[model samples]
Target: MSHSAEHGRVRAGYNAVAEDYQKQIGGELAHKAVDRALLGVVVEAARGGLVADLGCGPGHVAGWLAKQGASVVGIDLSPGMVEIARREHPAAEFREGDLLRLPAADGEFAAAVALYSVIHLEPGELRPAFAEMRRVLRPSGTLLVSFHLGTEVRRLDEWWGHPVAIDFHFLESERVAALLAEAGFTVEARLEREGLPEEAATRRGYLLARRDAG
Candidate 1:
């Protein structure tokens, strides 16, 4: 499928399951101590500047960051998800936007987070997506991205009893880090851990990088 077509499927799929996903995953952070800690690092790095939660689903992470005093904005591809996020977390702003073409000005954010967001992008889209993230961030801005670790493309024809089409692409930490570097980010840290028992049985990788100052 073309990129636009694939994106449409993802958008439609998430829209179909937005409310259900919110109900099931909104409170997930409460049980993820490591995730919370990593987010905390982003909040600190923001230093009172704007923080963009790229591909934010349901705004739970953005709300959490807002409560920590970070100026937060949540961006998602699905309008349904954006609406639910706005309703559930009035403290932060939410907008419907594509990650490949973010709806923000250059150097608009001091930090950006894309937790499990890049998994939707096709292999060839990784570098461009990372470059777009870099374009929106100020020099030296922090970026934190997480995704499942492996080499598999998992397609779901149905999710949560909703008929939809979407593909989740697992990735390797080394490969992702190289893409980030090529997109003008300097890798600062990397973490790999087994999924929590209640979560999908897969390893997760997290990379923290900063936009090149030059």
Candidate 2:
């Protein structure tokens, strides 16, 4: 399918399952201590300034960061996701946007987080997506990315009994590091951890990268 068509399906899929997605994954950080810790590190590196929580479903990550004393804006592609995020996190701004073409201005954010958001992008789209993230980041800005680890694309025909089409692409950490480097980010840290019992039986990868000052 063309990118636009695939993206439409993804948006519709999330729209159809927004409530269920929130219920299932919104408060997931509470149970994932490692994620919380890593996010804490990212916030600290952000120097307490405005951060973009890219693909922030239901604004959970943005809300968590807000409570930690950082200003945040949550952006997602699905209007339903953005609406749910706004309702769930009134203190933080939530906007509907595509990762490959973010609406933010150049160097507009101090930092950005793309937690499990890149999974929705096909392998060929990774470069532009990361480039857009880099464009919105200030010099020396930090970026935290998380996604499933492996080389598999899992297609979901239905979620929560709602008929839909979406693909989740798992990527290798090393390959992602190279992509970050190519997108003008200097890789700082890479981590891999096993999934929680409730999550799919797959390893998850996290990367901390900093935008080049030059």
Candidate 3:
């Protein structure tokens, strides 16, 4: 199937459960630690350039990045999430697109953050997505990816056990590092954070990689 179709399927699925997604990942309610850690990387670097927030939902990360004085653009698969992002953050730009195949020019961003974003991609499908991420990032720019670490694919029953159909993927960080390296990014930082919400997969991995200066 085409990337668009796959994305559409995922989008439709999420759109049907957009509210649940919000409750799970609506910034402070969820993904709070991941958000702070990601923003720290950008702020500490003090770099200025386009930063793409792949799979950005409700524009939270993009809005935060923009508040930090970086140019931010957000993209998500779900139109419902995009609508919420637009509504919540009129200052930041949010559009509908696939992370596996973005609509922007190559080397356009100085940094990219996939905050718990790649969790939706199958493990084997990550290579192409990482390549596209590197393609849009300028040489030496950083790519930040955050996820709950695991060796197997698992599904949840519900958010608050509400019987919602929302679902996501979690991949091992080691495989992610390998894939990022294969995609032309030099691994800069790789570490795991513990003590995340038990409701989430406890192990969180944050990897910061850079495109070679070449």
Candidate 4:
């Protein structure tokens, strides 16, 4: 499919499933089991300031960060997701945007998160996507990205036949670290373990990196 068509398809798909996902899953799909730990890892690995939740579906993490006193903005491609996020968490700043090309300016944010969202990208799309993420991050900023451990892109998928777009591309933590480095980030921490209820698969992993301060 053309990228534009795919974008529209993805947009419509998430827009349709946005409310249902929140209602059915809530915090189940978030990395609640390891989110706190990952957060700690992020704080330790790099300086923190303006944080952004890229591909932030429903804005849960963004809300939590704002409560913790961090300036957080949640951005997602799905309008429905952004709407739901804003409704549920008024404290957070939510915007609809594409992860392939974040709307934020270069070095605009101090810390960033991809969470369970990157798994939706095809294998080749992951690297450039990370580069775009790196571009929006300030020097020495932290980035935490996660994925389900596997090797397949589940396209034309559905959530209750509502036409949800889910693509899971399993990859190694080491490989992700290499990509981060190529994208101008320094690898700092890595973890792979049991999946959270919000995770699409049973096994998941995350990589923490920092944009090179120098």
Candidate 5:
């Protein structure tokens, strides 16, 4: 499917479950110490500059970043998701945008976190999405990405008892590193951990990359 079409489906799916998602998954950091540690590293790397929390659903991650002293904005494809994020994170900014074509100026951000946000993109579209992210990041900007680790696509027909359409694509860590490299980033670190029982029962991958200063 085209990226636009996929984004539409993803938007609809998230809109259908925005409230439940926030209630169930918003405070997930409380349970995942590993994720919190990784996020701390990401925030420190940003060096107190603007950061983009792409696919920031309900602004949980953005709120965390704010507490860590980084100026952050939350962006998601679903208007409903953005609305909830605004309501929940009254101090932060939330905008509706697509990952393939972010609504921001080039080199507009110093760091970005796409935590499980790109899982909805088809494998072939990953590179372009990463390129868009890189384009919006300043030199030496840090990027931290998290996603399911595997080689398969899982489609959800319903979420929170609401009917919807979306696909979650799992990818290998090595493959993701290669794609980041292809998008003009240098992979700086890679972390993998077994999923919590609350999350999907699969391994997860986290990669930290940086834009070359030169």
Candidate 6:
């Protein structure tokens, strides 16, 4: 399928369960110490500059950053998610956007975060998505991305009693790091951890990268 078609499916799927998804995982940060620490690093690196929370669902991450005094904007492909994010987290701005084609101007963000979001992209699409992120970030900007660690694609046809279609692509840390390098980012740190009891039964990977200054 075309990228647009895939994105449409993902969007529709998220829109169908936006409310329930939020209720299920909205306060997830409270349970994720590592995630909060990594996000804190992003906020500190931002230095009061604008931070883009790409694929932000329900604005929880963005909201957490906002509470940390970072200027944040949450972007998602689902209008339903955006609406809920805006209502639930008034501290941060929320908008509908795509990772392959962000809504901001070039060099618009000091930092970017994509937690458990890029798993929606196919393997061939990862580099382009990271490149678009690099395009929107200033030189030396920080980026933190998290995803399931493996090599598999899991599809879901129903979520929270809603009929939908979506695929979650598990990725390898090394492969994602290499793609980040090709997309003008230098991997700074990498972490892998087993999923917590509350999360899916899979390993997780987190990579911190900096946009190459040169």
Pairs with backbone N, CA or C atoms under 3 Å apart (clashes), candidate 5: none
Report, for every candidate in turn, its global Cα lDDT versus the true structure.
0.97, 0.92, 0.77, 0.78, 0.91, 0.96
Which stretch of 10 consecutive residues in model 2 shows the poorest summed lDDT? 41-50
> What's model 6's lDDT at 54?
98
lDDT of 3: 0.77
Enumerate residue pairs that collide in model 6: none
Look at candidate 6 and tell me the lDDT of residue 143: 99
Candidate 6 structure quality by residue, lDDT tens digits, 113-154: 999899999888999999999999999999999999999899
Rank candidates, lDDT, best first.
1, 6, 2, 5, 4, 3
Kindly indicate the candidate among 1 and 2 with the higher lDDT: 1
Report the lDDT tens digits of candidate 2 across residue range 78-179. 999999999988889989999998989999899999999999997889999999999999999999999999998999998998999999999999999999
Error of 1 at 187 (Å): 0.6
lDDT by residue (113-206, candidate 4, tens digit) is: 8887777676677788998998899888889988766665556677766866654566777777888888788877777888544544467788
Q: Residues 178-204, candidate 1: write the lDDT tens digits.
A: 999999999999999999987999999
Candidate order by decreasing TM-score: 1, 6, 2, 5, 4, 3
lDDT value, residue 195 of candidate 2: 91
* Model 6 Cα shift for residue 172 (angstroms): 0.2
How well does each candidate superpose onto the true structure, as a TM-score? 0.99, 0.98, 0.86, 0.89, 0.97, 0.99
Which window of ten consecutive residues has the lowest lDDT sum in model 6?
A: 192-201
Displacement of residue 19 (Cα, Å) in model 1 is: 0.5
Can you give the lDDT of residue 141 in candidate 4? 86
Which is the winner by TM-score between candidate 1 and candidate 2? Answer: 1
